[model samples]
Target: MKTKKLNVKSRTENLSLIRDFVSSSAAEAGVTSDVIENIILAVDEACTNIIKHAYKSYPDGELIVKTKSTRNRFIISITDYGKSFEPDAIPEPDLQKYYRQKRVGGLGMYLMKTLMDDVKYVSIPGKRNEVQLSKNLKLTQQNVR
Candidate 1:
């Protein structure tokens, strides 16, 4: 597997950098454009969530973006050492209530789950919070899908 890690500050200045890294990594791995887009979108959603929620209180920690790729799969894990949040506890974004309440937020996680093939979160109190995301790309005619 090919792997790379980047440290981002609180300002979200590394969003484009993250996207570029994902795109280049996927392209080199021969991933299709559609698959690459999906991975990038999912990763972006996760990173955005961490920046906006996890580090919202303390803006001094680093947001770790790690990208890993194998022959048939790509995994991106975003780790934050800020507040502990368990993704499992997030209520299914009650879209019905959202529409009735006319709220404009709370859809990042929904999109992440929809776009990524696998999404899992692990939170350790006073330790670390990590969300591992993955996607499987099949090869078609000697090329990645």
Candidate 2:
């Protein structure tokens, strides 16, 4: 297993950097391009939510991202010191209603859930919040050849 970590301020501008890190890490792990894109999107959404909700009042708050990979799986853990949140508490959006009402928000968590193989959230009150997103690399690797 290989592990890498990145720490950045909770600012939107740093999303690109995070995306690039995920892309490179995924590619190096022999993940397919399609899966790589999914991982990137999921991580992006998770970070965006942290910046927008958890650290809403603290732009300078720290956001720590840790990535670990094995032969069959790739996992990313994002940690923030801002307010904690319960991801499972957010009900799935009603697509029909959203389209009818032309709603723009409330899609981040949905996308994260749909794109990654597993999503887990751990919140410790006023201490820390961690969101983990994992992707299965076995199937993607099987399709490589």
lDDT of 2 at 117: 88
Candidate 1 lDDT tens digits, 12-103:
67778888888887788778898899888888888778887888835677888888888778888888887888776777788889999997
For model 2, the stretches where C-alpha displacement exceeds 4 angstroms are: 100-102, 139-145
For model 2, state the Cα shift of residue 80 in Å.
0.3
Candidate No. with top lDDT: 2
lDDT for model 2, on a 0 to 1 scale? 0.89
Quote each prediction's TM-score. 0.88, 0.90
Which whole-number lDDT from 0 to 100 does residue 9 have in model 2? 95
Cα shift from native, residue 58, model 2 (Å): 2.9
Estimate every model's Cα lDDT from 0 to 1: 0.82, 0.89
Worst 10 residues of 1 by lDDT: 136-145
